[model samples]
Target: MVKTPLFKSLPSRDRTAAKKLVAPAVIGIWIVILFPLLYALYVSFHDWILSQGKIGEVNFSNYITVLKDPLLLNAAKNTILLTVSVVVLEIAIGFGLALLLNNKRIRLRNLYLFILLVPMLMPPITVGLIWRLLLHPDLGIINYMLSLVGLPQPIWLADPVLAMITIIIVDVWHETSFIILVLLAGLTSLPDEMYEAAMIDGASAWQKFKFVTLPLMAPTILVATIIRMIAALKTYDLVYILTRGGPGISTETISYYIYKVFFVFLDMGKSSAMAFILLAIIILMTLILMRVMRTAEQ
Candidate 1:
């Protein structure tokens, strides 16, 4: 057997050309990512109100105030709940469906996948708007159908708990498609030789899944989860269009709350501070996912 080196060194001319090709991307990153991040950090430490139309004096206690606010705490709690629920639900459902479709016995797999992916392909804001109208108490098709069936037609986004639950259900429906797509790709790309070996060993279906599939699929699952979790943490458009974090802040997530502070309340400094906090949170979660992926790979 022969093994080949993964990387090949380019000739000097090719190397120079490669550097030139990558320079624009690096510059774009600096302009798009680094500059805004630095500006946000700078703004976070100062007292700036949009109404004032100026970045005011530096207020070192900005973070302290943000941390102390009860509403911030509430929003953080809501965000955590929403993120955890949606991620877990999406991953479980997506993986199950992916496994089902991955089986050779499954017919019309592409059609099923196409239908499932429709929600995800649509704009998130559009999904939210459609769901909002569908769940409307008076005129919604959902409630009208419920009335026809003699079932109770509850206000989907009116009550606190129900509003949160409504948001979660809608989110799961919208985001699960992404997880399925990613995990399905991973499943299809897995080496068939390993499965053949498992079958030769007389491994039971459950055992094959537990020992063979799970271990191999762990990293892919973690990657999908990390992407979804980051997006969930920054969720605002859906919340904005659907509930607007209404029903007495029941569905108010950190991102939506931050948006309100930044735009509605016109508190740029506080909003920037909250945004940084959320960014730190996302980075921490990504690091944790990376660590888990490393362990799984090992």
Candidate 2:
């Protein structure tokens, strides 16, 4: 039976109307999200007071001053350190856990997954406060346990290096579950025929994993890592609550530094400039990830 012209063409008008209705929603979304970002960029180039009438002129002075500021540079460096350390550790542990849990023998898999996801679901401020209590030199559980073992407890928060280390540890703890869940999904969805073929070809377990598993799982791993990096780089709540960017700027990551500039110092211009710099860095990294992974997939 041949379809009538009315039947074929009736949907076109509906789709056009739907697109027209969606246009305003799309524009509103752009306005809400992109407007603030573009405004922040504009503020970064002008020396604008938070309470001023208008930002008179735009210049690169804010960027220049921020770049020349040693404290800002140190904060950027520390932020990079925090992001890299957390991502590396989380990926390793997350993948390891995923591989282990992927086994058929693990009982209560759903329960384990639920427990692991608790940290990621918790509020950042709560995690910070909880870790602060745990890392407390005098009354914390960690120190108390160490004392029971007849060891002298070190000041975890007071010491700069220890403080940074603690932040990284907490970050890894919180985010590894996300990686685990994504990887577990990827692992379970994998075609078993590849592994079976490898076994038929007399390939060892390690070789099958190294060649077949890794390549297929690369896309999932890349997505997880990118997400984790983005979250880690923007980490502010944990550092803020735990150290307050204290111990003499030792654990001062970029987000916390921006908070300090905007709130503590009331330097919106400098803060905006620093924010734009961070935005540029993240955007570049995302683009690079896309290119490398696209090529790899091909």
Clashes of each: 0, 0
lDDT of model number 1: 0.92
Q: Any idea how many clashes model 2 has?
A: 0
- Whole-model lDDT values for every prediction: 0.92, 0.88
Write down the worst ten-residue block by lDDT for model 1.
Answer: 1-10
Clashing pairs in 1: none
lDDT of 2 by residue, 95-158 (tens): 9989988888899877887888789888888988999899888789999999999998999989
Q: Residue 189 lDDT in model 2?
A: 96
What residue runs in model 1 are displaced by over 4 Å at the alpha carbon? 1-20
lDDT of 1 at 105: 86
RMSD of candidate 1 to the truth, in angstroms, is: 2.7
Task: Encode model 1's per-residue lDDT on 1-298: one tens digit a residue.
Answer: 6998844876889889989999999999999999999999999999999899889999999999999999999999999999999999999999999999899888899999999988988898899989989999998899999999999999988899998998899999999999999999999999999989999999999999999999889889998999999999998888888889989888899999999999899998999999989889999988988888887778
Compare the candidates by TM-score and give the number of the best one. 1
TM for every model, in the order presented, reads: 0.92, 0.91
Model 2 misplacement above 4 A: 1-12, 51-57
